[model samples]
Target chain A: MRSPGSRLRATITSYLLILPAGAFLSVVFLYSLARLGYISVHNGNTGLEGPAQIDAYRFIVDDPLFRQAVKHNLLLLLSVPVVTVLALTIAFVLHEGIRGWRLYRTIVFVPYMLAIPVLGTTFVYLLSLNGMLNSLLQTIGLGSLRQDWLGDPSYVLGSIATIIIYHELGFGVVLFLARLLSLPEEVDQAGRIDGCTWWQLRLRITLPQMRSVIMAFVTLELITMLSWVFAYVYSTTHGGPNFASSVLELYIFNDAFSFQAPSFAAAAAILLLAATTVLIAIQVKRTSVEVNPE
Target chain B: MHGVSKGARRGWLLALALLASAALAACGGSSDTPATSGGGTTSGGKVELTFWYWGEDDAPGANGWLASAVKAYETANPNVSITVVPQATDTFTATFATAAAAKSGPDIAAQWATGPVLTQVWNGAITAISDLVPADETKHWLNTSENTYNGKIWAMPEYLIGVPWVGNKTVLAQAGISTLPTTWPELIADCTALRAKGVTPFAFGNDTYWTTQLMLQSLSSVDDVVQASIGKKSYTAPEFADFEKGWAQMASAKCFNDDVSSVPMSKGTEQFAGGKAAMTIGTDGNVRAWAKTLGEANIMLGKWPTYGSGPLKDYYNATQSTSYFVTSWSKHQKESAAFLVFLHSAEQINAWYAATGTPPADDRFDTTKITGAIDKQLYSFNTTGPQVWLQNFFPPQVDGNGNAPAQQLVLGGQGDAAAAATTRETAAAQWRAQKPDEVKNWSNFHPGG
Candidate 1:
């Protein structure tokens, strides 16, 4: 062990080492958060002379579109589980050394690597009414299944969610595959020697060991669905066919940029941040308990 | 022994510091350069001016005309050099807004006709173009009221964009119709006659909601719509109901293309361009564009069919398509005004007309330059019967949030007149709440002599 003075000196050095990063965070992130909080109460469109109004918060809370946007985001959360399971299943298959697995992996991961606006635009064209998807369906004698994928309010949110899942599937697969590849081979060998079936080995050993990774991915997906879908919504439907697919971020943008009501947008942003933070906290707490029951 | 000697280490650190300094300088170089660029007089004492504009993609040959105009201006005045910044459509407004807020944008920037101009003027971001250009010259531009504020014109009108109903005469002839519709009854009959022969009467991509709103504007007085926007008249009034009923009549007649709702406005408008639909109503820009596809001889342009029969029946949905304003912070206002005046000159206006086929707002743009019959007719209508555009008068939020979607809802059969009207009123109420000052200063505009 180091002497007391030496340990103290090292401690001081560590503090000195972190000072730059701490100062940066305080100035950039914490300062912005503080400013956002300030603007959330004050009118953001006006100068300092503008009166403070808590009514901005009240207005957003009462707006039906705000409620609708929240409901749409929550509904899209359903895609998280579906995406997670589909990715894990595919990753497991790839890990089993399936034929052409490398090519398959590359093809599957391509969408995640592509820019969101490009993918969203491509999907918009493909899913449009006179687009190739519908034309192909009609050609194949599946004409009855033809629907207005983007125009119908009932299905618009679902369409956006579907696009989100399709884009995010590649990311989830890559993440799970990375973890699966790094896992020990001995556990699988031991399970096989103990007469465990393939299904049993996966369910009993592999999945249990992957609990932490799965939880982390789910938390990430949850956060993403909450905050990271503005481009898809903007480029595709523009939150329309009558505000059917309007998300919180789109609402904030419309308020701030379109309406010139930056105060209301600021308040809405705070609510979105608070809601996402609460959900993420609950997920993190649940994950920690699962990882360490003692 | 493995470590570098003390001298070598110091040398390495010095090199690292120099590299960091270079990187910092590189980053600083970009932001330090003002968006409008430095504009002090050159060593030869020539003034440098910066100009920014958007919409080259949508208005195909605008950039070419602007560049040629700049070259012409620079050649004529050897003491001046102009730099034109063509901005992307999506980021133009927001970027300008940010730059204007910082008081550090281009000396001259293109602005949309009314709402955007009004917002900028309200914020005191732009100088009145009238202050630069003479009144005699300013009086020649069309729809000056749209950008007029506080007894002065805030922007220089560039081109006139009229919303007229254009037709593919070949498509109409194929449907056994020889003449264009001129009256409300004739319009309905035409819709029926075309549909009976398995042709859509109108091609509408209802995504932008212009399909329904433009039709409504055609069927009603433009003044009523403007009054309704500013709370002087209600959308639930009898006139709007009649308009809605007329829209329902067209909807029941199946006037639109098969996949109208599913397609965007641009894609839907293609039906007419492809000769699938007999007619479509749109801005003069689209009309000029379609003229390229369906030969100039095959295209026909006319005012919307008269609904009730009044002066408004003859009025065109006319406004300055876009305008340019001198920034309040510009150091070279006089030099910038000189360039602005150069754009309105007979030579540049002719070049603008030749390149874009858009009628220049400057009356000096010779009508003899127009070769096509349809182009001449459009110019005649624009020069004679301009009317206030309802879309341009509303606050951006009101038009975006209420008008666009409510029309979509109504056309989709999900809402009625009362519901759509209520949405409009609510949007107006929101606007009023947000900008009571603008509302108090609002004055209803009437167009034409």
Candidate 2:
């Protein structure tokens, strides 16, 4: 058995190694989370910490805007699977060494590298009622498909999703491609020698190995759909056309800044944090199983 | 105010003490008295002031004017250095609230007049200008009443703005129209004629309820909006919401652009400014900006077509819409106030009008310097009437949650005027529940015509 002093020294060394990240987390994440929780229970809108109460939580839950914003965020989560499938297909095709695969990969990845505000602004213009997109559709003799992409409430969410998917697809593809390339070359050789069809080889061999990465990516994207869409909604619609495009993040911003209801904003933020943390925990559990399976 | 961080919460007890002191000062201070030694310089004999300014959205040349004004002031007073931080239109008040909650920030800041300013005053986030500025200097400041709180001037007015009804005579001529509409019935008829002529009747953007200001044309005073807001009266009442019927009618008549619900204020209004639409509502500065592009002779400046019989219906909705004030925590309160005073100097006053063509919110601004026919008429309409812009009176929550969405419903072809009114009523009820402090404090504010 290790001596008490030696055990204590090892413990101290481990903690010392993690001290920087621990301090960073304490200052940045934990502090902000704690502050958010504290602010949620207070009536700061009237005065600073007027009273600690559940009024903010109760009020936000009853708000129609909050509900609508939550619904919009849920709808955005639908894009997660669509992006994953598209990314997987592209990655598989590129993995097969299709002609000009590098160029195709570059084209797919270029969008993710572009700035969000620039993309959002360009998309807003392209998707406006009389924007370039509709004009192009009209010129291409697909005039029947022309619709107000950003202006119409029914289409605004979908337009935002399309922009997000376009931007995020590259990251997913690159991630899967990295994993695909790293898998032992001998596995592919053995599968081919066993007379496995190309589709079967990829579906049976390549797919199962990426289970953890896929789960991790999906969880990350779900979190993104929940909270990272503020920039997209803000730049394009500002949660307008009668807030048909409002998301939870935009709702929080509106309450905190525009509406002067910080308590409500904090409450909403805490709800978002709770949801994201649960998702992260689930992802951690699933990936841990993959790492140390029985 | 929003954005009270945890770091800010630690200062609440101290802030409450400061609030008590501010309340004491409000009760006892005179306009001529200097409440604190704010003009004090540091040991290095240098006074630095950070000014958070807004209104460049309404006044395009304001940024340029402020830069020149700052340079001149720094040259004249070598001991003081000033930094102008232009505030974003979307987060103007929130950023300030975050700073105020922290109890340290810009020495000077701008906020919308009355309801927005008074909320800050109650929170003890600002210093009353009457304490920092002299009675003689502020006596010349017109519309100081807009920022008055507990018998002290809480904020300083810089310029007056009115939403003037602007028409393109050339565009109107295309529809065989000679006179701009002056009544509700006439506006409908003209809209029909304009529509028949393949022209957009009134270019407006309702994306954020900015167009809802026109609904205030029916309310008589600030108290009317206040009463409706606090549930003493209903927002659904005929007098309060009747204007929305005209808007709904206008929308049904297809008087606005098809994209009215989707576009922002600048884009929708630019359709008029760029000569694509016939008429629109605009600030005096916007009126001047449009005139430059659409040609001076082609522009028609007038009041909103009459709809309500309220006392303020015929009067122009004109006042100091936004103003600057010194922050409570600023050490350079005196130097900041000094800069504000210099802004109203005769040279600066003339320069303001000349550069902006917007009438300065001071009594000393010479009116004759206004040469444009539209400018002269705008000045007369502003000065000769009771000026009450209703949007400035309501809490911003009601503006964002109630009026904006209600207007959005009608414009988007989703709901009728009654539905719109009910939306406002619901928003008001919610705000009253959320903010009882503001509602209780409103008893002290009796704004009159």
The reply for model 2, stretches above 4 Å from the true place, is A1-8, A45-50, A140-144, A193-195, A287-293, B1-40, B44-48, B78-81, B131-136, B329-335
Write candidate 2's Cα lDDT for A102-208 as tens digits: 89999999999998888988887788766789889999999899887877788989999999999999999999999888888898889999999989998888788
Model 1 spans with C-alpha error above 4 angstroms: A44-49, B1-48, B55-58, B78-81, B102-104, B212-227, B308-311, B443-449
Cα lDDT of model 1 by residue, A174-214, tens digit:
98898888889999999999999989999998988888788
lDDT of 1 at B269: 85
**Best lDDT among the predictions, by candidate number:** 2
lDDT of each: 0.74, 0.80
Worst 10 residues of 1 chain B by lDDT: B23-32
**Native contacts recovered by model 2:** 0.23
